[model samples]
Target: MGEAGFESRFVAASDGLKLHVRVYGQPRAGRLPLVCLAGLSRNAADFDVVARDISATRQVIAPDYRGRGLSDWDPDWQRYALPVELQDVLTVTAALGIERAVFLGTSRGGLLTMAMAAVRPTMLAGAILNDIGPVVEATGLVRIKDYLGKLPAPETMEAAVALLKTIGAGKFPGLAEADWRRQAEGMWTMRDGRLAAAFDPALAKTLEQVDLDAPLPTLWPQFDALAGVPVMVIRGEHSDILSAETVAAMAARRADLDVLDVPGQGHAPLLADARSIGRIAAFADRCDAA
Candidate 1:
């Protein structure tokens, strides 16, 4: 409800936790809505700009998973697994009466999207995987682990922007100061007169338990489930997560898959740019037509 007249909804998860979802626009009879799933440590706010644009044509729902943003944090951080989050997602969507829709997932969100394809294929009409694939590179994961939920509180919002720039500027060379500022605002919330991480710090424990040194399993079977659905992958030009080689392999599996290489971004392409937003909106239209 900040500017575009979107509604903020609190849905009850299976465990009775109130989950927050930012709903933009109204559900139409024929056209499918867009569900935006954010990266690890991110929230519904991350998709605000793109969601607003797409909402003009189709409904957009961006949800903050348990322990993130406005959602209630889980007392047992062990419940922060993908299966648990996926259940929460289904609960939110069912409460909203969404039968099938397009899913736009970034990083860890993309992983969840693949999981959905395996468990509830009918829920996905189309999917946009932003800078992630079945095969996650260990190096990128290590880099993410170094920062996730462990950031120091910035005294000022501007300092938060500066801090992000110092950490991510090298990977996202195309992002300007303004873009960083916007990201900082989305990523942190003011608490006790200090900017705090939008997500619960306990969530980090989920990653800390992972053994990066061990080889990660690929979700090729789950990804292959998307064969019947329209798929588009948005990879950052300099991304370390969704590598070009993986995209090539994906294309080999699904010859019809569409790929967009976002310039000057890394790990995940922020769908905040005009071109990226337009591509996604057009993809939604194409899905509706199909």
Candidate 2:
């Protein structure tokens, strides 16, 4: 639950598609703003709790990438690639008049953060990557592909919660029943009195094209571009996407990198928990002090 009365706004992407942003809290002078980027198929709502908590000290902004949440869906699904999404993020930063920010990126968002560091290093004050790294595990990619865009429409809220729990059982072990319900609310939208997934079904096409048998592209160079900027990497102990080996490599590359391992979570740890939120807040404080 982010602060009440957050401003809902939009900016146009290079393709003329409208992208949505949720701005929370007030901007404090001399403090770097926080920009949150969600995972693929996720929206600004995913950071509701985190925004509320951090905004008390500095401004927090979360944007729904094109084709997800309130943003305009691309008619050509191929535009959903990383380069295009990275440009869209740049457009958002420009539209908001943000000169610099501490990026809090999760999953695909974390990949975008690395891309930004490579292309627009000066714009980033720091970054915290949640459950993602230069190397992605094939097992995790397979799991995501299994149900990416193929989720069935739920007849009721109860059904939606059940579906999420069924698919997310081992992934989010300690999450309460209420958290699952909240996740359902964020992931699906009620249209014409029926619940359908909030994101465009075409999003799955991007994953479908990936050949798991072949090696996936490595982003280590992009990560290396962030050498001077402060960085924090968080990993869920059971995360299939961000393996322990990748985390070690990331740490090896950046001697000053802050690392945290959240126990009992899988692909990603929800930042709503006190421990995660506190860690982020402390990391931001250090970035600001520097």
Q: How badly does each model clash, as a count of residue pairs?
A: 0, 0
**Candidate 2: where is the Cα deviation over 4 Å?**
1-5
For TM-score, the strongest prediction is 1
Model 2 alpha-carbon miss at residue 3, Å: 7.0
**Whole-model lDDT per candidate:** 0.91, 0.91
Could you estimate the TM-score for every candidate? 0.98, 0.97
Per-residue CA lDDT of model 1 for 1-290, tens digit only, reads: 66656899999999899899999999987889999999988998889889988998889999999999999999999998899999999999999999999999998889889889888999999989999988898889899888888788998998999999999899899897778988999889998788899999999999999999899989899899888899999999888888899999999998889889888898778899999999999899999988
- Per-residue lDDT of model 2, residues 1-290, tens digit only: 33354788899998799999999887899889999999998999899888988998999999999999999999999998889998998999899889899999999999999999988899888999999999999999999999998989999999999999999888888999878887899999987788888899999999988999999888899889888789999999899999999999999999898999998888878888899999999999988987
Model 2 clash pairs? none
* Candidate 1 wrong stretches, greater than 4 Å: 1-4
